[model samples]
Target: MILATCVAPLAAFACRFNVRDVGFVDLGSDPYRLYLYVGDSMPMAERESLQSISTATFYDSNVKPQLLPLAQARQSEARAFIPEDFTGGVPAAVLVSPDRKTTLSLPLAKSGVSVLQTAWEALEPIVDSPRRNAILEQVFDSYGVVMIVEGKDVAANTKVRSMVDAAVSETTSKLPGLEKEIQQPPVVAVISTEEMEAERAFLWSLGIREVKEAPRVAILYARGRMIGPVLDGERLNRESISAILDTIGLNCECGLDRKWMQGVMVPLKWDRDRKQQVAKQLGFNPESPEIRIEMSQILAKSGAGQGIHRSKIIGDTLDELLTGYRTKGLAPENPPKQNKKPFAESLEMNKPEASELMLSWVVVAGILILIAGGAIVLFARRRES
Candidate 1:
């Protein structure tokens, strides 16, 4: 009892559900599908160039690259999405969205090695600015990020900007009471209208192609997964912003659907070094397949009402990942354990047999009758005397 009381407060501060871990596992669920077209008669140089994209650092692990022979490409379901007149020949490529709704094509490597280089650029366009760099750094170090994409109206943008500051302040005040200890408060970033063009690819990934009428807010956490829908108009209020931030600070096993907690990730390369730094902060490698698998399973079983021991599963996986957990920062402080049995199971285990209950009742009745008969005999003796 004493140990539990001492640890409970400390556990309240350490967030069990990390956004970075959630984002890393989310990538497993949704990866860009890159299909490379090839032919038996293709030149060795072109074939090699197309194959190199799979190992490219910028390609990121989130892209699943597949080599498809030209003959098989025609028979594939993807053939319908390809244009009839696309005579780009061998060494061509098609990039499909995770949902298979969007497709981008890279024409044949016509202009020697340079054309292939262009194809790589088109496949994964790197978009960054000074503001984006700060945002990325903050997300790595802090709990999450709240980004404001400014609109054309200066007055409206100014008004919405205050909303972020107020929301963040309120969220910070409530952090101590949260189930999870937040590493840091969410920081705010702004993308001016002028800089939006340079960050078109980044914005597009967040489903913001252009910000025209009013400024919008996007809440991103752990490798840049948007927490929920973009807030604008009347939805962009202090209370709404605080509510979402509060949501992220809770225990992930709280039964919220993964879909509600996760959205599209901003197109950014989460390389190994950055992942390592995040791992140190989180105390476990989110890059590990074992951890990712467990996280995916948790999200899959979310809201199922199954007697799934979620925290125990994740804690065991983390323990295996790092030995001497306390010294290495691999262990969650006082990880939640499902030690108590379910109500039905407890009743079944402790319930007495019906026969035993009846026998005990009969024995008690006989004792009471014997006492009553003895008392009556004593009363008759006194009367006779």
Candidate 2:
């Protein structure tokens, strides 16, 4: 019984899919249909792992497999049979080998390294298609990682790192429009088992400023274990994570958990002092919340009730509170307008003498009246004679 229980957790871990299961056959379900693309090269074991990880309630990963020959794969007709092509058009993340060049070339390429470019070249037209609305709905609902593992010649760890780098580059390059559409900067975090200290230094050299802001990149290295939390315990190394994130133009938070040859990389920010102060003022424990009547009352009054309304109400209340502080002179006053032009300066630049201008207008009007009077008198004298 003891052995069985111990083995069960391990079995569950093995059954779970990591980032590697991206390009496998999809069996309907919204998340799978939106996020994944299956290629002929995917192994059966990996396919099974993907299926196990996906909950059937939201996605079904057991659809009929469609295989295509490498030669025919380039054709639109043949590509149509692939899972991504059929369901929602194309996957957000695409995996193509180094030798298998794309029709549209990316900006930079490293020698002999595999590139996983965004399939945007093929997707742009489809996104504009009249039939693409439903597919877009699915894309918005699904979010997952794409993994591109290079074949035997490349080391497993190297392939993982290369693929992650390629994906980050590809995603970032295409994200300008996406940021505008979403109204928030996109976040990307890279976690790796290999440590690239020199690469981290090179990134900081490019002028990244602070790492917690949106549209930042973070890279983390895990030495031994393959998967776990990025860092263990309280103190997080903000400097290291910030540098890596800034290099890639992504806001990031990262930590290393030595147990899983893996590090967790996330685009999350935590302000230690701010959080502590907030916790203390709110009368709750830091790091974890201990419920009190006042806390409950605050939450309830601030709309912790339900739905999107909760966040909206809370935001409204916070805004009001801040505005109140400003009105009371607690907040610094805004600097007076520096661009206001003085009346004297304006008159000097565009001046006209008021008396001279009025006299000129009066003379012009008198001359017009004299001409009209002469014409009328000449007509009356001719009639009398």
Candidate 3:
């Protein structure tokens, strides 16, 4: 694996995708929120600072920036979650979760926009470990990464590592047929238990606090979303690996629920050059307004994408555990559309009875067997005669 050498740090998957890409497409991910609270009367210095910082974070990275009236912030649904004692003034900044359940409020009144800028910098902090750096470097171009988090037991770690290696090999051999344009096949990266401690922030981003089990496999794809649950013990196997890879390789339009595709992602630095390079390769901008609307429409039809609800976000740790700094398990809300169908009919289509389908298959098998038997009999008779 190649390592990233002195690359400028920036948020990688910020606004790109909140979902997985088994194939080469980045369907789209939810962007983080940055709300600036201002009033009818404000100083020009604070105003200038807010504009400069918000503009930079919005265009240059994955975080979304919004300017809200101070009065609006007071009435906003997210205000309830803000720390009551923090007492950030009207010219404040609220860093909100995609789900809007958790918020970190900074007093822009005193610190200016520097406080918010500092918080944004924390989103994509530099990593010290070489193994993780390599992952950050290559994950952008690959189908996904099969990360084998090593544990204290050498034997257990070795065993899981070998299984993951075999899975990666098998998956790679068949990659060309799956997504021919994929620049690289699925990669296998290992995280030593020691390295785990060193990069706890990175591990935390993956919802991994500790290595409860020595060897675990995390299936990562679509800009670091860890699809499905983390696997260990009986759950980690060849079948599970194939199931995930097959799902990723499934056509983006296969009608599978996007919920299964969305996973928690690690926050990595994604600079402009890399983002543009990927966009050019993808043949379209995943973050473009048109693409976002299309994804919203897809999610809306499935009743999963109508934006996050304030009621769902309860606690910080719990939300983090469930969403991995992303939104998940969204309630089904039907967004109004033209010529909508009845809910029941929209969910499924009519099909032939099971008995009829079985009979058809049985009849085809019988015909094929008869043809083979007749040819065998003819060949034998000719030879004997």
Candidate 4:
């Protein structure tokens, strides 16, 4: 009991689930969502389409409608309106509204990932596809501050909105020509301070001097560190905001400020199934030689590109591959015993039944011999007397 009490502090640090955090992303059953099934295997054209669509989901948060992998959609218990045949082929899309009153099954575009945007746009006129606000909470903090301005004053609001817009444009203007080189825009939100009473401490923590009383712009960056000028409402202008935006073009908001409440909010940041299945499809056999060579070729073909994401994904696949190896067919888990022995010795090592029977026979033979010897001894004694 004493030892357990002493070690109790260590228990709090242990992670019990795979998810880091789950942020609120309008998971209401009523919103329209597109369920896309891009299974393990895809032809060259289909694979290109899937990759493009998947990439779009990461970059543009405004691409209306949630993009849940069809496999995950069916498994997600939260979704009560899944159709019976959602388990079909690759490169398929099902668009459905919250009410289930209107549903449409659309053919995927073989042209490329453009299919994702096109598919959503088609549903815009017909259904009310609810979109979550594109405020990436503190995502680009390391790169630079994303000034979230909140106030009722028209002058303050106009000044901050102009500064925010100019900053985004100015920063994006200098990015490299390639799409992959560019990043998603950093988050900048303008809202009423009175409406954000619950976030007073959060605003204050961002270095805002007079949060509720005056026009304040909270600049969050350096992973939650506050910038003094913006919060104090002194340097709320184009030059200052652009200066900050220039440092980091855009940031990945995939896992940014995502939080969860236990098992209810498991992460979809990393797909556990697709990663393993895709690696298998790529013919990733860890047991084979020339692994590095094979991996390079596979990654090039995959079009996932070289980055932390590529490394992480391939690593996950290899881990699953090794796990598959360990659990494969009838391979002896333990080596055979070294010592050779006769059948009798082997039997003795086994259950006691055979040994017990042998002992019984020996005991009966000894009893008979003793009885005969006694009879002969008695006869001799009588004759001698």
Model 3: lDDT equals 0.56
Measured with C-alpha atoms, the lDDT of residue 302 in candidate 1 is 32
Per-residue lDDT of model 4, residues 1-385, tens digit only: 4445434544432222111111111222133345555543445565565556544543322123444455565677424545555554534655544344444555554465555456534333222211101222333212333555566667767766766777666555545421123234445656465545433323322333244434555444322223224433555555545533432221111111111111111111213443354335323432234543432233233212121111112122223323322332111112236658888787677554554467656656666777789899999999999
* Model 2 root-mean-square deviation: 27.4
Deviation in angstroms for 282 in model 2?
11
Which ranges in model 2 have alpha carbons more than 4 Å from their true place? 1-41, 44-266, 269-296, 302-322, 329-385
Candidate 3 displacement at residue 106 in angstroms: 12
Shift of residue 204 alpha carbon in model 4, Å: 2.5
Could you tell me the lDDT of residue 91 within candidate 1? 63
CA lDDT of every candidate:
0.64, 0.28, 0.56, 0.39
Model 4: runs farther than 4 Å from truth? 1-134, 137-145, 177-180, 209-214, 221-232, 250-385
Q: Per-candidate TM vs. native?
A: 0.64, 0.18, 0.53, 0.28
Predicted candidate 2 versus true structure: per-residue lDDT over 125-155, tens digit per residue: 2112222222222222222222221123235
Better of 3 and 4 by TM-score: 3
**How many clashes show up in model 2?**
20
Best-matching candidate per TM-score: 1
Q: Between prediction 1 and prediction 2, which has the larger lDDT?
A: 1
When sorted by TM-score, best at the front, the candidate numbers are: 1, 3, 4, 2
What is candidate 1's TM-score against the reference? 0.64
Worst 10 residues of 4 by lDDT: 254-263
Off by over 4 Å in 3: 1-28, 34-59, 64-75, 83-97, 100-133, 179-183, 197-201, 211-213, 262-265, 268-271, 283-385
